[model samples]
Target: MTVPPPPWRRAPSPRKRAEKPLLSPELVVRTALDILAAEGIRAVSMRRVAQQLETGPASLYAYVSNKEELDELMLDAVLGEIPCPEPDPEHWDEQVKEQVRRQVRAMMTYPGIAKVAWNTPIPVTPNALRQGEAMLAFLRAGGLDRKQAAFAGDALSMYAKAFAYEASGWTFGEYDPAHMAERERRMADYVQSLPAGAFPNLARIGQFFNAGTSADRMEFALETFVAGLRAVVRA
Candidate 1:
């Protein structure tokens, strides 16, 4: 007989070959969101996510059709966490700002979720639609017409998403507090070293650069934007 396959070439153990449970789209999306939260968005992929679930890429197809769909799912999932407040005309400005703040906080916690949030189409998820309705309601209660309310909501949301995305991008890799401080010092020095006359504002404010806490920046931005909204409403 042809030299039989060596004993060392035996097939895998039968126990190890058992079929895995059917993978669902929800499972894939949840695992992907976890991966995105733990690692950066770059760490999320069909192959990697499938590996996390102990399955093959082919199996994931039974649920998520493609990367785009998975991204949409993750974004909607993130949006789901934001609680929609009842429209309170007396506190609509504060309410809307708080909602945006909460959303930004949630997105920042998940690292790359901000990027996904930016380009994801108008989400059709129940939570997302409900949020939109609530936002429009709040704006309208604050005296905006339907079209103005819709546009203002979209513009403010875009700003929040972009701000959070940039903030997340800055903290992507292994972050060390000491190292970050050193880097900030270097940046401040660089700015300060610029020709003082040519860059008076930057040189003068070098000490202020990267000096504020995330909360401080968020509050400042919120106040400024809301003040602008008040002006718009009054106009």
Candidate 2:
């Protein structure tokens, strides 16, 4: 009876499922970030990540509660990559700006990671808390009270996240340069066509609309914010 049926006639030997690799928090986060890097944020999902890890979406819940939690984890992982410098009282303002610059640069590496940070308010993740602590130290070095430092740090974070999101859009080629150039040209033409008296301010500044590189703009923004911190502290 065991003389064997023909290979094709034999019922497929109950296909042996490949053993799934063990799941861990680090693995889950790394999988998600890999998906983000390869296919952008929109392609990353519990199902997608689980598929990449050779499991089901339900399996990811043991490691991450949900997509939002996954995003927080991803952002925290990115934050972990950035160095937190010691506070320098003599150059605290520059130090603060440098910290923000580092954050923006790191988030931009993964394109949409900054958006995740932007959506999360008061993230309690370890690296996020570390970043907050470092920023607070910088502000304290510059003479802000705890309340002022907290407020300033929050504002600076928002500004950096917003700028990172914007920079990512351009840096990652989300918008085609040729298309953007055409759109800008049409916009400039439309602005020029408007009556000068009806929209005097718009007409005056319209020429400078796309005048600066993103780095130039970021430099201006950071310098302005840091320079204004003392006034805010006094107020």
Candidate 3:
């Protein structure tokens, strides 16, 4: 009869197998955010993230339960980039506007995160909670009562998130000078072609419609909203 392999050579003991270092939730979240920033939100998946980490999907499960948890973690990670400001009653309006601008800028940096952010429930992450606390403090310093401060903060954040999400849908290539110029020309021509009496405002302001830069539009919108908030709070 042929000699059989020794039983001792059958397999290595579980204890002798190399132990994999525990994959931390923070590391997994950071990698997911990196993937999201490079490739849009749709590109982020547990398997894909695992591939990037050079591990099996099961390894990710040890940290993130599912894609939803990963997304929430990623959103929180991005929110952490915005720094909270010290509340100053003398400059509450300016501070609020600056903070909102920072939030929008952070969302824009990540491309698709803003769209996913608003859909996620008010995030429970410390960074997100800190942002809320800062906003509330600023509003209260502006003389708003507790309920008013809370509601105002929610409204302002919702507006900022909505605007950022809408803006993100427009790709960078679509904003090239030449492309925008052509777009403006087309838009103006279309508006001018409308019956004069039907769209007088649009026709008359056709040039003005394309006059300002994107930065100008953003500033104008922020100013108008802040002005309205001041009126409402003072009233």
Candidate 4:
């Protein structure tokens, strides 16, 4: 005899089955960023992201045209995290510096974004535009003409992004203490082993190759950049 209908079929149960979350642009970019944070940018493939979201890769194509689109979306999404402050005419330079710091801090949150920033043009997304505009406003408020402001803004932004990229060290896999020690050893050896006569300068300071803490270097860089930009302003 046929068994009574299974429970699920017997009464389409009062509770409806839980529906799976549908894929969206936000989810795809977010998932990709999470992967980029844990792994390198190369590790964030559509298939991999799809797997993370428990869906098929085809579903992501509807949101992102391809991996390039996905990368741009990821960049824009991260850029949105950087807070854009009001430009104070009285202390525009300081505000600009603060913006650079905020940018570097934000980029550092995602492990490999610094490298991505180098090749990818600045995204013209909503938040990214706001950030750029605020920076330009600061430069203009600090007595820079349109051209000077544009040039200085671009330079400051590039400097911040490049600094963050170098700091990340993800490209060289230096997160491990052992790897870093090996790198420092090789660097010191090569620098010290160089022919002293030909390379007097590097040889003399070779012992100080890995000298300062990262914070020290970053502070020096920020101060020097602002100083140089001020030179252009005064000139």
Task: Give the poorly placed runs of model 2, Cα more than 4 Å off.
Answer: 1-20, 171-179, 197-201, 204-212, 230-235
Candidate 1: segments with Cα more than 4 A from true spot: 1-22, 174-190
Assess every candidate by TM-score: 0.81, 0.83, 0.79, 0.83
The TM-score, computed over Cα atoms with residue i paired to residue i, of candidate 3 is: 0.79
The runs of at least 3 residues in candidate 4 whose Cα sits more than 4 Å from the true structure, single-residue gaps closed, are 1-18, 171-180, 194-198, 204-212
- C-alpha local distance difference test of each model: 0.82, 0.88, 0.81, 0.81
Candidate 4 worst ten-residue window by lDDT: 206-215
The lDDT, on a scale of 0 to 1, for candidate 2 is: 0.88
Model 3 per-residue lDDT tens digits across residues 1-235: 9987798786655677576555899889888888877877768899998988889999788788998888788888888999998999999989989998999999988877887788785788788899899999998888888988888888888977887886765644324667777988898888888876998766786544443465667788778877876887789
Candidate 3 residue spans exceeding 4 A from truth: 1-22, 172-189, 204-212
Error of 4 at 234 (Å): 3.2
Query: Model 4 — TM-score against the truth?
Result: 0.83
What is candidate 2's lDDT per residue for 75-119, written digit by digit as tens? Answer: 999999999989999999889999999999988888889779878
Give the worst 10-residue stretch by lDDT in candidate 3. 206-215
Residues 1-235 of candidate 1 have per-residue lDDT tens digits of 6787678897665575667666777788889989998888989999999999897888888788988888888888888888887899999899889888888888998898888877775778766787788788888888888888889889878878987887887665635668888987898788777775877776675444463666677788888977877788899
Cα-lDDT of candidate 1: 0.82
Clashes of each: 0, 0, 0, 0
Better of 1 and 2 by lDDT: 2
Measured over all alpha carbons after superposition, the RMSD of each candidate to the real structure, in angstroms, is 7.4, 6.0, 7.4, 4.3
lDDT of 1 at 120: 74
